[model samples]
Target: MRDPWVRGLRYLKGNLFSCPPQEALAHCISEDCRMGAGIAVLFKKQFGGVSDLKAQNKKTGDCAVLRRHNRFVYYLITKKKASQKPTYESLKQSLVAMKTHCWENSVASISIPRIGCGLDRLSWEKVSVIIEEVFRDSNIRITVYSL
Candidate 1:
């Protein structure tokens, strides 16, 4: 186990999609992307499609794990309704679920954007704490991108 807060995590400022691909790319998403904005656009364009994301977002805290271009990407449903922003509790729970899935599946590394900080209107300071707390002792390496 490594201390992700100290040395296991990398914080990079760039487009999340432009970074080198990793085993997984994790980000928060609404139950539906009918509004069409944010990272959903990239997911729709580059990652095959978001139909799976739409299907999986039926419940709050639902996680849609998809394989694209031989890599895994996660869409954590932090928002229950399409119109509402995601809540901190939902984001935390989603991350916990994702962590469990990744550990069980032996995912070595994951790249993520600052989840819940953009359209969801949450604080990165708070969400970062939750992410660090969830993955601090895990063997997986994490890279959080800002764009």
Candidate 2:
């Protein structure tokens, strides 16, 4: 087995929608499934699975997954409501749940933005560390994109 690799682009300079067709896409959202702000709006518009994600009844520390075509879309529930803020603990739990889904389904790569650092106001430095720590033992390649 090999160590998992996580890469961040200094400038990222990529589109979330343009990631390789085979790679999975992930982003943070609230448990209420209201993706009315931030990069989440794009995710909702692109995937359009509001009812399906809500049907899962995911909580603040859970991950809601949507299988579209040949890839997966991971929705990390980091807060109880769209108006509420998310804690690092909840973020970490969501990531772990997403990782479990990835491992179970043999997903090898993910394309994501600087999750939780935009409108959510999380420190990128802290969030990045948590992401690394959670996936350290898996071979899944994580690509963190920034604008």
Clashes of each: 0, 0
Number of the predicted model whose lDDT against the real structure is largest: 2
- Error (Å) of candidate 2 at residue 77 is 0.3
For 7-124, candidate 1 gives per-residue lDDT tens digits of 4567877888876665589877777645367776677677755666666644677677888877788878788665788888898888888888898888888888878887778998
Worst 10 residues of 1 by lDDT: 1-10
C-alpha local distance difference test of each model: 0.77, 0.89
Give the RMSD in angstroms, all C-alphas superposed, for model 2: 3.6
**TM-score of every model versus the real structure:** 0.86, 0.92
Clashing pairs in 1: none
Provide the RMSD of all predictions against the true structure, rounded to 1 decimal.
3.3, 3.6
